[model samples]
Target: MVRAEILAVAVVAMFAGPGGAQSMDKATDCGYQAEVVAAVQQARKDRVGERQVQQHVAEKATWPENYNNAIPLIAGWLYGSDVSMRDIRNEDFAAAWKELCLQQ
Candidate 1:
């Protein structure tokens, strides 16, 4: 019974109105955003650790290869749009920005 209730709650949370997280401005942009997020989320769920996620994000956002440096750019916009989008801090944002944008 407890497990069923938990499953129900998870379903409700998953299907909740789109008002909670920052909605992507453009629908087309959501595809890549979802892809990057899924990668990070999967890494976290696999217990690869936050450092692993950071490294993966870094490698994924490298220039002239994947998305031409769109991952962290999208992440920054998402961060600005929704404070609760992720637990990432300003320092993380800065590092990502520098690595993906400035150093690219």
Candidate 2:
């Protein structure tokens, strides 16, 4: 799963055309948010994992600590809040990502 996610991100970065870091960040954040939301929706359907993401317009925020990629953010949220995906917010992503790291 991680490998696939990384590949997807890389492919997107490759064909996404050159842009300022801000544009790249916006794209990355959007992609990351989508993945996280999918996990939440999946968990809701599958009845597994925590659901802590709150559905809302997440205020722009930096990536979580000890991680520089979008994958970790989604992974962490899925692992931390199993069977309980809520609306995702940038503020809560770090804690979720931490859980994913520690648990895995």
Candidate 3:
């Protein structure tokens, strides 16, 4: 379970984009990478908006520290799927992204 969580976190972080250092503190505080990833997946499926994604991210605030390293992979997948930050905000993309990273 732990390993899977790490992988998920890695994958989500890969596509989460740059500028993650600023969020390290929050990621540590949240401490639940799986929850984050699940939220992102749900957000994408729900066709969420960017502002919502920002709000969701803000709610967790600390996801970057745990998943930032995987942003490239996550971004590639999201880009391939036409899931933009704007669209993701409306859903749980932020949480899902963290969950995905936990898998790695």
Best by lDDT: 3
Candidate 3 overall Cα lDDT vs. reference?
0.46
What lDDT score is found at residue 73 in candidate 3? 38
Supply the TM-score for candidate 1.
Answer: 0.33
TM-score of 3: 0.32
Off by over 4 Å in 3: 1-31, 50-52, 60-79, 82-104
Model 3, span 12-67: residue lDDT tens: 44445465434454344234444454544554556655345534444554544444
**What RMSD does each model have against the real structure?**
15.5, 10.6, 8.5
Each candidate's lDDT (Cα)? Answer: 0.38, 0.39, 0.46
Poorest stretch of ten by lDDT in candidate 2: 51-60
User: Runs in model 1 with CA error above 4 Å?
Assistant: 1-25, 57-104
> Model 1 over residues 1-104: C-alpha lDDT tens digits?
23323332332334234642235333323334345544444444455544345566656552223332334433333333343334443224333322232211
Give the candidate order by descending lDDT: 3, 2, 1
What lDDT score is found at residue 102 in candidate 1?
A: 21
TM-scores, all models, native as reference? 0.33, 0.27, 0.32
Per-residue lDDT tens digits for candidate 2, residues 8-44, read 4543453345442335454454444444445444444
Backbone clash total, candidate 3 = 56
